[model samples]
Target chain A: MTLLERDPKSPLTWSGNLPVTSRYTFGLAGEKFFRAIKDEGKIIGSYCKKCDHTYVPASQFCEKCLAEVSDWVDVGTIGELHTFTVLYEGYDGARLVQPEIVAFISLGDGGLIHRLGEINLDEIYFGMPLEAVFLPEGQRQGSILDIRYFKPAG
Target chain B: MTMRKVAVIGAGMTKFVRRAQETPKELSWLATRMALESCELTLDDIEAVCMGTAPDSFDGIHMKGEYLSDGAGAWRKPYMRSYVGGGTGVFVPIQGWYHVASGMFDVVLVVAEEKMSNFYPHAQAAFLTIFDHTTERPLGPNLLWIFALEMNRYMTTYGISKEDIARVSVQHKRNAANHPCALLGDPDITVEDVLNSEVLAYPVQRYDVSPVSDGAVAIVLAAEHVAKRLTDKPVWVEGVGWNLDTAHWTNRDLVYPRYVEYAARMAYDMAGIKEPKKEIHIAEPYDPFDYKALHHLEGLQLAERGQAPQLYIDGTAARDGNMPVCPSGGLLGVGNPIAAAGLMKIAELFWQLRGEAGDRQVPGQPRRGIAQAWGDLMQVGTVVIMGR
Candidate 1:
């Protein structure tokens, strides 16, 4: 027999909802990474000597060499802008008074995603030099926003 | 020990829309019912059922596969859900092929559904949680950011201009005019129109992306012998392959999707296709983002590395071209309901090979077609090959 052979009648609709909520804590690796930024204005990365690679988020193991990596190295404060976008909307689906600039910053060894600051929209381009702008120590928190945003470096 | 053969006998789908009054279960039921009816079969005919859907976050339900089982026509019989983010649409059919090919089931039903409208505060916002919580989320990353970054890197690496990339949106949206299920079809769209559209992110504009949509799709698969009895013409599943890249997406170069290439190779090897560019008649690579279609085209071995963007400029990928692509309007032109969109590709291949694709049929009557879906943190790639 052929399919959908009959002009099928539409079925009745049902509307319902199941509210769900949850929370999780950052693990050890995250704890240490965040502590370093909060305690001291230092950015560290996991150095994998086996494959000669560095990860900005400080991974527990090297993805390439597959070796346990505890070697922490300083991943400088400055980076290069690989790419950027101007967003007119916020995360909550609300329009922002001013455009937001989101960028992928390429450190020498790894890449970090963050917002850009203090740069003219027209001046932004691929390969533009950038440096992390950390908030004052008194106001620092163990979060990515502690570094505030990345801005064009002289 | 030789493996049994499997064939697709029928396909069904609900109209793609931004919002549907029906619930997820109802959507699945409609599609499944149509597939069964088209194949002239009843629930008793299906030996097993497989459900394919994207993240549970969109549905705002945990254990999405389990929830969708009943409506997918998997109430009591063997049931399973195949999920790999956006690739689940095509992957579900591939998984169903296994049921018949393994001699475990004579007939299998495959269904994919996504109700993006179900999420509160807009569907786009739910994607925010896909970012890394410890390192990346602090940066307030959104879905468009990754696509923009990849698009920038690809353009810079290949020396491809935004105008060249925009051509894909222009061509695909124009082609969508013939697709009844397409959400944003426009025959008069132009390259300039894409460039001038609002920039959600640089290089990715309004037209360069697929709309967030609600849709469901289903296909009935039967063993070779059973297919012969059910339908005069059957689309055989010649080959299927899927691969995943490392989750450390930032650590590697995004210029090329190596995972997709590996996946295509696996499927091609199974299909015994050595020269894809010359052998395959049509293709439907995932196109959630416009550039991704070209990226996957290269991965599918349809064109040389860093060269797919030029195919559209030269009129090579048009529906009437020698190697037509996404004749069903693709996720870019049609609505993108994630998993449903991908399965829609396989459905397109089935209908196209049977010469049943009314207004969107490719000329010359194609014999072989390929469809692919990609998802999961720029990692997973799923491929399926079919022939009449």
Candidate 2:
């Protein structure tokens, strides 16, 4: 290995790129979550009454009781602030113009992680409440982003 | 499977560093050489070898095991690589323990190495695939997001204050000061310092996280009879167990690590330990994040659910406390090179059990010890039980 200061000869690095793309089918469980939000304009979850547990975005199987969650329940859009973080950096190693407020919004009996829209950094605490502000049904697609972001609850 | 008894005769490691000029093979060779030197053994004495490493993406190589084999002293010898994320470190010994204990090999060498700094831009950029590619990836998730979410859930469920959790950093970093091999061993680190550090994610701060590092650690293991001949102070591998939860982490309760509990129970049962809190004299739980240490402590049954924070706050989890945690400064104080950090904990335990730890030695003889690591997508839990 030659010094870069002189004439570079180190063979330590190889630069190349691999293009990868694929489509995934979310199967029976995931399709329900997407369809519920897309067609019905509502959030749905798999509620295991035996364990009294409901999962956000739905799961095919119950982890705690090892039972199939066939029963579906419509959960409220309003939820509590489970926990959150203000990310100073992005995944690409760049500083963001807006320090993204990432949070786990407690929805249904279970919860989902989403971006917090309205933020007063000083006032944000662990248990602060929040509500999901959805995009108009016309603009909404069968995707999690269709919910736009969660805002501070009234 | 019934396993024959196995013992650790020696351990060696390269100093944890943010970056290393040495290549991955060179780093592995260095640690392997040091391990052999410590035991006064040659490569010829080894029967087989097992290597532990994280992802190929971090090392910027495909077939990471094949590339790392020679450096691990597996040239023309029986060799294999076992990886289960960060758990790969302790899992190395667990795999090697099986080699010797099963009477398949009289001696086995276990090594773990990671060159996280080798990744371009940032080492974390390579972790993108760990998330659900279609669903979660679309949301722009970083690895820290899972930790923050879990920490948020844990803190909220237990009413645990960030200040109370910050004490793990204080305790571990201070203990790391005594460790010569430690990378960030600053005795002056305080809870105030941790709390005041940059917030990477909610409830997670810069000081609360372990630094990314490049390092390697190796250990020489032998069956009971050979081990007795190799070293008079053989640290016996009493038990080993590992478990992985569902990859879909959102489905599970983040407050309790049932997977870690299951893994610990398996190891403790095999080790004949009914009450780990009373029996485990020292613990070196993985602390990639400071909160993880406390989280794993509760999982290991060293502390009850929601009680680990109080233990740290009450000074009950300090080095001189009734049962010490992370006496080797852990990943928080020592640099975390992923797999290497896990093996470093085992090395520390070997030294502690044999009373060979210089400044980092625990007061009173530490006879029984446990080292655990968690990995995967907020899933896997790996545990090892060892004794003098």
Candidate 3:
């Protein structure tokens, strides 16, 4: 009802806050597995013996099972897109020239969500298959972006 | 042998917003004043105050309850703040029930507020604080990522899709068009619109999420004797319950909110609601995201497992449908001021149960209604069962 323009005196704002250093670093096993994807063009997951559920972007300990998840499983890079969305607006209201396609790619027993690359937004379907495409090892940053995103399989 | 019955004697709220220009104190004062006026009572009438707020960072104000006490009319009164993050709204009423149920106070003024607009640069950054500060926060993960993951898991387990989930946004926003305080109500949205919105995380788009908001809501609760003397159509507080799960969110299966189910069971048992699907005429479940509404619907036993999305698609959850939900447009349509958003749902349930919801009311005289709110690191769930 009362729309006021941005005033410095306004009680709410996010001016000085900034995420210092790297904002995308994964944890222990997550970092290792993500690096493997970048250097070896492979995906990996962690298995919890107690829960018997595998976790992607491998974790040292099962979050649900709360048990040791030391076993590692290399997930195939190829998977199907379970769901997706296209982004036209950046976080701070900046308009994007080309919408980015983000999707959840389901792996062997678990799934990982990421930005979809080299794909048309309209062409994406619920069950469409895709594969992870890695950046060159030299350019790998050990982040989710290391793989860029799951692209259409050949 | 039983505890004293309680009734909501007053209710008030401020205009919901994506970002408010006023300070948290000013916003809380606005709603607190409105509530006192509705109840024909002054600050002196409230013997105690129970405040509920979602998080400390949303407003960039820490120990927010104490910071907000003056605005909530707790200046020098016996007061305490309760939090279950998003669940704080429903949790407030439950807190009030205890105050009255314990005979500690005949009148407890319950207030909920969230000034999310305070986090200006990008609200997503607040997500970092919700994680295990020691273990999980070290990893850069946004709040949307968790919801997206949970939604992905829910969809996988239930065979649902983005279209099915978007249908909820479309329907609720359409319903919200009638709510005066709604912030994101749009009847013209298509699944394409939601799909094309900005991506915060995979399976989560800009449109699928509730907007960050600044707002406040309040309700004055009174014991049976006081309620009977004040109004004839008082809605009785039948039952209330809240529970929390393990903090390790990633450790649990995201497909279902078992904590919410357990919380609901506690409330239903106390309320004697054996068949929520049929016994309860109207319902309001938390809906921070479109999928959350469906998830909570299943959790509240309003529908069978995986059957919530189908109800949304079949016009079953519509205002005039078999089981109406989020009639106040939910958090999806109405502004989501976090704590205030959940209370807004409770307010909607109050209006519906009393047949005062105007266009948003369920088809007939809904004798029994339920309002539930979920919060925390996917851990807290609160429920309130009410009947007229």
Second chain only: TM-score per model? 0.98, 0.99, 0.97
List where candidate 2 sits over 4 angstroms from the true fold.
A1-23, A46-55, A60-80, A92-94, A107-109, A119-130, A137-141, A152-154
lDDT of 2 at B230: 80
Better of 1 and 2 by TM-score: 1
**Residue by residue across A1-154, what tens digits does model 3's lDDT show?**
1112365654444465434454544567766686676677778888887788777657788766568788888878898876655554454555567766666677755666677788875686767889888888888755566676788998
Query: Where does the lowest 10-residue lDDT sum fall in candidate 2 chain B?
Result: B129-138
What's the ranking of the predictions by lDDT, best on top?
Answer: 2, 1, 3
TM-score of 2: 0.89
Models, CA RMSD each: 4.9, 4.0, 5.2
Q: Rank the candidates by TM-score, best first.
A: 1, 2, 3
Residue A39 of model 3 has an lDDT of 73
Q: Candidate 1 chain B: worst 10 consecutive residues by lDDT?
A: B117-126
Q: How far is candidate 1 from the true structure (C-alpha RMSD, Å)?
A: 4.9
lDDT of 3 by residue, B186-233 (tens): 878778888877566557777788887889999889999998898777
What is the Å distance of residue B171 in model 1 from its true position?
2.1
lDDT of 2 by residue, A1-154 (tens): 1011221543455565445668878777889987877777777889898998887778888888889999888887777877777777666556567788887777776677788887787777766888887888888778888778888888
What's the count of clashing pairs in each model shown? 4, 1, 3
